[model samples]
Target chain A: MKLLLTGSAGFIGSHLAEHFLAHGHEVIGVDNYLSGQPRHTRHLLAHPGFSFVEADVSMGLPTDTGPLNWVLHFASPASPPHYQQHAIETLMVGAQGTQHALDLARRSGARFLLASTSEVYGDPQVHPQPEAYWGHVNPNGVRSCYDEAKRYAEAITCAYHREHGLDTRIIRIFNTYGPHMRPDDGRVVTNFINQALAGEALTVQGDGQQTRSFQYVSDLVAGIAALMALPGPHPHPVNLGTTDAITVLRFAQIVRDAIDPTLPIRFVPLAADDPRQRQPDITLARTLLGWSPQVSLTDGLTRTIAYFRALRAEQQPVPTSGPAWMRGAADAGQSAATPGD
Target chain B: MKLLLTGSAGFIGSHLAEHFLAHGHEVIGVDNYLSGQPRHTRHLLAHPGFSFVEADVSMGLPTDTGPLNWVLHFASPASPPHYQQHAIETLMVGAQGTQHALDLARRSGARFLLASTSEVYGDPQVHPQPEAYWGHVNPNGVRSCYDEAKRYAEAITCAYHREHGLDTRIIRIFNTYGPHMRPDDGRVVTNFINQALAGEALTVQGDGQQTRSFQYVSDLVAGIAALMALPGPHPHPVNLGTTDAITVLRFAQIVRDAIDPTLPIRFVPLAADDPRQRQPDITLARTLLGWSPQVSLTDGLTRTIAYFRALRAEQQPVPTSGPAWMRGAADAGQSAATPGD
Candidate 1:
């Protein structure tokens, strides 16, 4: 199968590209490197089945990439820091980029999968978000860019599916962390692992009570591939993530144990519109796609920590500003501000 | 104050333009008229304060528009029939048009008010929907074009407010009905009124018990203006709607009575993602804007019925093709059978 993967140089996209290529699929990956790294796809350059295109989907699709079997649109900034920094680009990817990719997929008669996010379920009141839970989101909040763009992206993809009958799948991805995870990625798992490896205080937000379920990248990629491969009677979004919930403080402790025994943990104010609790109810994924996160957080963090450590040993500049852990010192402390009213 | 109003030729936008003009504001109104009617604004063509430019905001801003004091972005296909006809255009207006308007608002240091919809709360689970409901939407469903685009528009508007302090105000406008509505606008008010005027069957979706509160255009405009003029503190989305909830059957009856007493009513299957219930909890509006609906549904419908009667009496041709109510019953019936997956 020939697959065209957008955002193929990002953490999850790179992993997905690698998975498809290893499984004897011809992978054509594209990225503008706005937030993604060329280094992420460096190992794949020599692979016979993998080809990379440095292009922006928001500008338009690659000129005449004819007749592909599948297009996995993983473009757009998935992390808060990257999205917040380049909001216009983030929105364009959601609106224009998704449309362009869907157009390509439609023309080629290729199946398309959009990488949506749990952020669409903004600060959800439901304990474990089912596919049905309408989220409780502040549309005017600081985090609206990432959350709403993904929502719109999902909508446009659906429009293509319904109006044009393009084979489309959407995965409402939860937080996933693993080895190739960017050092400065603001997600919790990467933040904790990096901090623990550097022998720094692991910072958890808002008294460390906010809970999240972290799915390993490998598990998420497997789910993505499976959902795409599902032949029929499957069109709605599948919630792909671990259902096991854990407090941020507990996750910090686990990371401290895995990386360094003596690293202290600290608590900071939570970010605006950040969900207090998050866990995906993966019943549909189990019933339909027969997939769930197999890698435990403990195991995932061990692999992630080793990767970050090796990268640091090579004198890779640890991100000084962008990572979630280093936003501000305790002295710059303010109460946890919710996103704007 | 110089106000830039997008979708200025559309139902709500035209009304908003008139209000601003009457208030002695210079109004620069732009609309590509994709779903809008030039007839809606024909009366205002000669107004000294009114300036009209025909352009698509999704492409970019009109070159002639000057510094705006306030930007009312009411572009996009508001009616389901219009949106379903121009899905890509609808998506573009919500995404790109919104971005263009926000960019102008940011540069002009103008307060931005995004005309979002109750559609953002797609098939909401919560009743008497507040401004906080995230919405139960099928990302891959048929109606996602409008539902998700508006959600994304609101999000990007908020990002501008947060990151750039663009003075943005978002109004989750509920179903609005009044004079100057398109004859076959596909909204319940317009649809029922048209059918009753034409002495045709008043088609109700499903069992016709699905309820919604309709706000008069004037009342909604007042609420929107008050929200835009709000000073200090609460700039998030506030529900701008009436609390008068009525079943679709009841609504059809009311239109029938208002238009022609002899018209019969019929129940058709509901459209896909047609929200089962809609009533606004306008507590935030009352607290923030000191506003509520002034026109009752009966009075509003009376006025609307009169206007549409005049419109139809003038020998206006009702569109009769796909999804058209008259001769295009085939597609309507097909849509009823398989609304959206």
Candidate 2:
């Protein structure tokens, strides 16, 4: 099968690109690198099955990508800080970018998959949000650019499916963390890992009591692949994340223990419109795809730490050789982790 | 002052254009007649201060409107039946039409007032929704094209205000009914009035217990004018409807009594995603704009009934003349009624 993957230079997108290539599928990757770094996809450049295009999906996809079996749209700024900085861009990407992707799918008769976020359920009043839950969202708040845009994206996607009978799927991705994450991306897991590696105090927002369910990147990739392979149009949004939730403070502690156990924690004010807790009710995913997150948090964190440590070593003025395991993880450019950014 | 009004041939927009013109403001009216009827603005065409342009707002505004003092975006099909029929068009008008209006405002340095709806609340989980309430909306539902589109309009309006320092105001209009409403428009007030005038059974949705706060079009026009006149960018969304609520059954009876006292009634299944109850918390409107709905329901309904009666009389084969009072109300087109469509 051949696929067109948007945001292919970003963390989750790169991982998915690699996963699909490994499965003997030819992938055409596209990214403008607004929030995505080129280094994330540098490893995949040599792969025979992968080709890359530099372009904004909001404008239009490259015309010469040939026919596609699947169009995966994952091209928006996922983190709060990044989206807030590029508010208008984020809104446009969600609205116009999704439209372009859907158009591509409709023209090619390819199944379209939209990477909708858990932020649609803004500060969710319902625990373990199901796909059936109508989200409580502030359409004009500080976070409205991302939240409302994603909501609009979902609405338009479903519109295409209903009006044109286009095969479309939406995956409401929860908190994901792993390698290829930009250190300054301002997601909790990356923040904790970076602060721990630098031997600085980890900053905990508010009381650090707010919990978030983290999904390993590999697990999310698997779930997404399974969703793409489903027959016919699946218009309903499906939740894709692990249920093994942990408090922010506990997450920081786990990162600290993996790096340096003596790292201190600093408390700070929480960002505006931040969710208190978000855990996906994956009953639909389990029933339909027979998929569940397999990687444990401990193992995921260990591999992620090794990757970040190797990155820090490479950035040093006098590069110090890291341990074989750490070097191996970094060289392979693969980790059983997820992206929280 | 010079103003540009979209959807100028529609119920609320026509009244607003006349209101602004009466207040010594020059008005350029634009409408695609998607849901708007050109006859509603026929009277205003002779007025020196009013001009009309035929164009879809979702496409673009009239280029020769000159410098705009205010851009009032009241376009899009408001009623359920019309919007659901043109679902994609409604969504595009809300998103792209809004963007075009905001761009016009930004270029001309005019204050923008978006005619948002109470539908944004989307089956409110809270009673008498305040400005601060985060709406409960199903983004992928059938009504999402309208509900989410309006929500996205608000978000983009606010985004322009915050990011570009563009002056913008949002008015969440509740159920409005008045003269010049399209009789076939599928709203409770129009449905009831038309059914009564045609000597047909009034169709009530569900148990007829669902309540809606009806605001006279004149009242809404007054509030919208007041909002546009306010200094600085008032980015917060203000509710612009009366707090006095009435059940659907009561509304139907009021119409029945005004038209034919013995009109039969029929109950039907409620439309999908219909709001159960909607009442505005207008404390902000009271404090900020010093605005309130002055027209009572009984008086408004009487005026609306007169207008519909005259319309029916005009359509008769024998051309029987309506009562002098009804003819006078229809001629003036200045009734203090509201639109439920």
Candidate 3:
């Protein structure tokens, strides 16, 4: 099968591109690199099954991208700080960008998969949000650029499916972390990991009691692939994330133990409208796609720490005068303040 | 002031256009007549202050209609049945149509007023929703086309305001009814008035216990005009409706009493995702714009009934065989089966 994947240079997108290539599918990747870094997909650039295009999907997709069986739209800034910085861009990508992808899918007779987010359920009133839950979201809040745009995207996707009989699937992704994450992405996982690696104070917000369920990137990619392989167009949205819940402090501790156990913890004020907890009820994924997250938090953190460590090593040569582990610690600390999800 | 008002042929828009014209403003009215009727604006065609442009704002605005001092985006199917029928169009008008209006506003440096609805606070958990209440909405439900579209419109309106420094105001309009409403618009006011006028049984949904605060169109127009006259951009959303809440059964009784006190009511199942109760907290509108609804329900219902009666009389020639009041009763009964709101 051939696929057109957007945001293919970002963490989740790049990983999904790799997963598709590994499964013997040809992939055409597109990214304008607004929040995505080219280095994330540098290795995949030379793969025989992968080809890349530099373009913003919000404007339009390339015309020359040949026959496609799938169109995966994951083209917006996922983290709060990034989206807040590029608020208008985020809104456009969710609205126009999704429209472009859906139009492409409709024209090519391809299955369209929208990478919707758990943020759609903003500071959710319901626990372990199910696909059936009608979210409690502020349509005009600071986070609305991302939350409302995603909601609009879902609405339009359903509209196309109902009006034009276009094949579409919506995956509401929860907190996902692993390799390829930007060190300063402003999400809790990357924030804690980078702070721990640098031996700096790990910042937890508002007593750090707020909880989240993190899904490993690989698990999310697997769920996406499974959903894509299903027989017909599944118009209903499906929750794709691990059910295992953990407090923010516990998550920070796991990262600290894996990287630097001696790192001090710092408490900070939480951002306005920050969710207290978010856990997906993925019964639909289990029943229909027969998928569940397999990566344990401990293993995921270990592999992620190894990746960051190797990244630091490559950026700074091992020093003969001081401890080799401390060579890139200073730079990591400098850039660790911008944590991402 | 020169104003570009979309949906100018619809019930509220027509009244608003007249309001602006009466205040000595030059008005350029645009409508595609999707849910709006041409007959509603027939009187305004010859008005020196008003000019009509037949175009869908969702597609694009007329370029030649120069210099807009204010852009009022009021283009969408408001009533549930009308919106549900044109679901895709409604979504596009809210998303793409809103974008077009904002772009126009930004380019012309005009104040943009978004006609958002109380449906943004979908099936509210709060009794009287305030501007501060983050809405509880279903992103993929049947009514999501209208609710989420309005939410997206608000988000994008704020986006344009923050990003381009475009002056913007959002009014969360609650249930409103008056003259020029389509007899079959499927709102409770029109529904009950039409049924009562026809001397047919008024159908009340779900024991008629659900409550909605209905604002008269003239009061909404006054509030909109006051907001438009404010000196600077007020980006905050304001709730613009009455606090006088009444149950659907009570509302039906008022309509019946005005048209025909002997009219019976039939109970029926409510529509999916219908809000059991929705009343706006207009504290912000009162403080910011000094606006409040002044039309009593009884007076509004009487005027609405008179309008429908006149319309029925015009459409069907009254026979001399029976009393003049019973002349148009047969047609009203024939078309009163479909309940609205």
Candidate 4:
């Protein structure tokens, strides 16, 4: 199989590209480093089947690419601070970028998959959100640039499926964390790990009772591979995430224990519109794809912490890192806007 | 004020065009005739202050429209059947068309007013939705093409306001029925009026107990003018709709009585995802803009019916009309996707 995978240097996108390439699929990776790292692309560049395009998907895909098989749209600044900082660009990538990808998929007669986020659920009213639950989303909030854009991407993906008979896939990925994640993308998971490793107090926002369901990236890629392997026209969005709900404080303790047991955990005020609890009802994924998260929070955090610690030893910073909103946010490190708390 | 308005040949666009023309503003109107009527443009062409540009906004706006004080983006196929059939176009206008409009607004240093919709609330969990209500919307549902598009439009509008410091105004219009609506735009209001006048049975989808707020176009125009008249940089969206909630059955009876009391009424199964009740929480509009609906239902229905009657007398079909799905949707004649149930 051959594929055009966008945002291929970003956290989840890079993982997805590697998975496909390892499976012997010819991969054309695209990214403008809006929030992606060069290291990931540089790593993929060593692979024989992987080619790269340095372009913004919102502008348009490369015209010369002889495409076949699939088009995966995974571009956009997914982190809260990144999207908020690049608000218009985020909206454009979701709106126009999604359209351009769909158009390419249609022209190439390739299956299309959009990298949607659980943020579509907003500060969900339902504790465990089923794909059937219409999301509760604020259309003009600070996060609207990301949330509404993903919702719009889902809308247009369905439109392409219905109108053009295009085979389309939508995955509403929940909070996911793993290796290859930036050391500081403003997500809670990374904030805790980096703080613990650096001997800084792990800052827990609010009382830290708020819980988030975090899926390991390997598990996420496994679910995607399963979904992609299935036959055509499964356009309904599928939720892929761990069902085990972990409170932010508990997760913070786990990260601190992995690095230094004495790392302090301090409480701070919670951010506005922060969800009290968010977990995915993954019944459909289990029933249809025979998939469930295999990696536990402790194991996932251990590996993620080791990766960041190694990067620190190398004296290299995370690539394309946005503003330093993370210095105090010992929150969920699953910040890449890819999937989050 | 000199202004640029897209969808000028549209139902509400034409009304808005006339409103500004009467106020002595130079208005350059753009429409691709996708869902807009040439006759509406013909009427406006006679006015010295009004000019028409034939173009699709999703493709791009015209280059020759000199400087502008305002950019009003009101384009798209709004009715359920119309939008569903032209699903891709609707998505483009809301996504790309909106961005294009915003770019021009930024370039001209003009104020931007986005004609959003109450449908953004998407079968609201909150009755009389306030501006602060986070909507319950199915991101991939049938109506998503229109609902999510408008939601996307609002997101991008806010992005422009926040990012480029572009002055922006957004009005979430509710069910507005008045003159210049297409006879067959498949909205509940016009369905009853046209059915009654043609001596056909009024088709009420369901027991018709579902209620909807109906605002006359004049009241809507007045609210828009108010929002536009405000000083620089009020970026938050304001609801510009009538708060009087009217049941579908009662609305049908009103339209029937206005045309002819002898007209028959029929009940059928309700459409899926149809809102049981919807009305605006207009406290903001009243408090901020000193605006309130002045047109009573009886008076508004009578005026609307008279206008359709005159159109029928002229023996000219509503121009640039789409499919004929309005035959049984007596749910609202306030079709055309401008604003409806």
Clashes of each: 1, 14, 10, 20
**CAPRI quality band, candidate 2:** medium
- Per-residue CA lDDT of model 2 for A262-304, tens digit only, reads 9899999998888899999999999999999999999888878
Q: In model 3, what is the error at residue B189, expressed in angstroms? A: 1.5
lDDT of 1 by residue, A152-203 (tens): 8887877777778788888899988887777888878878877887889999
Clashes of 3: 10
Model 3 spans > 4 angstroms off: A63-67, A317-341, B63-67, B317-341
Interface RMSD of each: 2.1, 0.9, 1.1, 0.8
Q: How close is candidate 1 to the true structure, as a TM-score?
A: 0.87
Q: Which stretches of candidate 2 lie over 4 Å from their true place?
A: A63-66, A317-341, B62-66, B316-341
TM-score for chain A, candidates 1 onward in order: 0.91, 0.93, 0.92, 0.92
Candidate 1 Cα misplacement greater than 4 A, ranges: A207-209, A316-341, B125-127, B133-136, B228-234, B316-341
Question: What fraction of the reference interface contacts is present in each model, in order?
Answer: 0.69, 0.76, 0.87, 0.96
Q: Kindly give the stretch of ten consecutive residues in candidate 4 chain A with the minimal lDDT sum.
A: A332-341
Record all residue pairs in model 3 with backbone atoms less than 3 Å apart, i.e. clashing: A184-A338, A185-A339, A185-A340, A186-A339, A186-A340, A187-A339, A187-A340, A187-A341, B186-B340, B186-B341
Model 3 C-alpha lDDT per residue in residues A1-341, reported as the tens digit of each score: 99999999998998998889989999999999998987756668779999998999998998777668999999989999999889989988998899999989988878999999999999998998999888878787889999999999999899888888888899999999998887779989988878887889999999999998989999999999999999976999999999999999888888887778888889999997899999999989999999999999888887887777766655654466876446555334322322222
| Residue B123 accuracy (lDDT) in model 2 | 88
Candidate 3 yields a Cα-based lDDT of 0.87
Worst 10 residues of 2 chain A by lDDT: A332-341
Root-mean-square deviation per candidate: 9.0, 5.1, 6.0, 7.3
